[model samples]
Target chain A: MYTRQNQKNLTSAQRKRFVAAVLELKRNGTYDEFVRTHDRYFVPDDEDGLRVGHMSPSFFPWHRRYLLDFERALRDLDPTVSVPYWDWTTDRSPASSLWGEDFMGGTGRGPDRKVDTGPFAHDRGNWEITVGVTEARYLTRNLGRPHKPITLPTAEELKWAIDEPAYDVSPWDSRASGSFRNKLEGWARNGAERWSNHNKVHQWIGGHMTGGTAPNDPVFWLHHAFVDLIWDRWQARHPGSGYLPAAPLDRWDRQRGRVLTRDDPMPPWNVTPAQLMSHKGIYRYEV
Target chain B: MRPYPTRCNPRTAAAVLTRRAVLRTVFTAGVVSATAAALAPVFRSRRTVAPAATPGPRPAPLFEETYRGRHISAAPAADGSRGGLDVRIDGRPLHVMRRADGSYLSGVNHFESFDSPLDLARAAVDELGSVRLAAAPAHHG
Candidate 1:
């Protein structure tokens, strides 16, 4: 078993080892593969088509497995290294420790919005964006989206989502309302604030973080780790409640071939959301 | 942001639609006719010259416009792939995909799908701010 600590609490040495492992993954081309994989699986839900990653009930499980694969890759380099979580609810500033030059680095600056400080900065020659939507080689970020003035997810906003009882509801997509999965996944269609939680944080970061190739920014793992922790907390709070859509939808149903049931196998590893229901002995979040 | 979640609200959407309809009619006549349109509104009305059919909302021009000082357009991809559209902003290619839900998403702002490719392209421009989108690599697996 391993512990995923809060990123703010990580010591300088622990941060060093984690950064080293990620840079190694980038050097060996494994990092780019993760970027490509996320871009590939970020399928949006539509009529009669399968979607396991985003916009579905499996968004949590699929990403949980994806993070496990990534953490395992990091452990291959150093057994002590575990992915840390960035609780955006608290660490909501550009000046926060999360963006310090010693670790994940600061916001992208200048006309190009390029990250020029910290280890992952482009000029350092250690990190280059190979698998990207655009030809830009540098990793970029616009923390707080200066001109837009967007804020991070608030603690109150998070409480509102975790309070939800059902794992998911009908249609099992982004538009699905009143589901814990949809709420935490952060697709708010009712008000002027369209993106609230997870999606909003992505927007707050801007640049490559806004798109499919977001993993190019090393913080992707930490951001996801925190999101994964929320699932753990949700599970503990609602032990009686479990994953919804327990059985596959009827064959005639439009969502039959599209949404993954509790037992349906998620691709890349063929593990079902049922199997990934709980982390348990595998790992635990350090709360 | 105007055409986003605010557009999702039925009440606000109606307001936007009402304003949009007026702008659509005024902008539809042509740039040269903008001044004379108010004076000769009846001549500018399509119903006066043509039939009453085709009286619904005029479709938005999907291509060739400057968005936030950035020139953006969408065209059928050269490869002829299904739902494949070659979108660009400021002369650089902006990758786009068609969702089964009939919305369009782009390389930037991939999470939030837009109602049309034009909206998707504009979102990318907004996300970029001052930084320009570089030419994407020829292939992405």
Candidate 2:
């Protein structure tokens, strides 16, 4: 099984190869397609099959499959090129090597919030934003702008999130304040702090990471790899929790009728939660 | 039913109008009252209750448009995946999404988040306010 390692752990050569592979993918137009898919999923309206991955308990599984799909695409080009995870907790500053000129790039400058440093920089001419809300085609960042700042989540907070026993509580969606899913997604508060986990990281990064087409940024892969890692950890902690909206299944979806179960078909993929939970033949995380 | 008195008292006749006239007046009064009551709700409905701002159509997906130096745009999460609302303004991105508990979420700020579309729109407007700043040359980065 292909092992996804931490971004900080990758050697210089590994980082170079990884960056090269990513740039190659961008050149081949594969990266833009991923951005297109993520942008489509982030569409705001809830009408007719809109937001199933996020806010719902399925967020974990859906992203598991999404990251896997992305990893598979990278492997298709070069088997040695594995997706890495970004530990924001360690590389807390915007000046981290991940954002250095050779890697993803640093914060946007001036009013445009356009990122000028790094390989994925807009002026680099190699990374063009073809999919997103605006027609402007350029990679952007506002790393900790004066109004908005990035706060890397702490390990204690992540530990608190994982410690929660239930997979999700009532209203098992993104808004469920106390549920692990809601807290991990960064919608609900963590008692002391208003922002937490995945959502916090996204907002903290701001710029392209916060946008609908976040996948346009190569950092999206590393960030999500960490999220997936957290999921695996949560699963290990609560092996019996299983998935939610399964069984006794009386929940009604006003729009679609019954709520989705673990056995229900996941969109954008043929597999179901039952199929994703194990991750046996698919791949493994090298945590 | 009450039996009619044999003698018609003139005083009573003077006090009460002709049966036909009385009936006409009563029916007319009843009709007017009913009509007023029936039309009451219509008038009330027409009266502006607070004049709360009506939410406009969900803003169209802004594709790579820049205002001032900030950018405003939207897009679906990913096709074939469970979808969610993803909005980006300059550096901040807002997610208007549903939760597992059936509640919706709108990313307002680092410290605050909301579930209402109106709130989401208002937050977005405020966030995009930076776009109103004086326009600079096209971002070269």
Per-residue accuracy of model 2 over A1-287 as CA lDDT, tens digit each: 77788887788888888888888888998888777676555423223243446656777888888888888877887888788899877888887888876667787775556678888877778888776544446765666545645478888889888988777765554456557777787777777776788887877766566656677778888998888888888889988887775654432222232234678887778687778777776667776
* TM-scores for the candidates: 0.82, 0.70
Off by over 4 Å in 2: A43-50, A251-259, B1-141
RMSD of each: 11.5, 16.4
List the pairs of residues colliding in candidate 1: none
Kindly report the fnat of each predicted structure, to 2 decimals: 0.41, 0.09
Candidate 2 global lDDT: 0.61
Best by TM-score: 1
- Candidate 1 overall lDDT versus native: 0.78
lDDT scores in order: 0.78, 0.61
After superposition, the stretches of candidate 1 with alpha carbons farther than 4 Å from their true spots are: A190-192, B1-61, B75-86, B98-103, B130-141
Per-residue CA lDDT of model 1 for A77-104, tens digit only, reads: 9999999999999998999998988899
For model 2, the docking class works out as: incorrect
**lDDT tens digits, residue span B1-141, model 1:** 012222223564575567657666865856454453353433223211211222345423347799888899875444423234557788888766555445776778866778877788888887887667767432333
Fnat for model 1 comes to 0.41
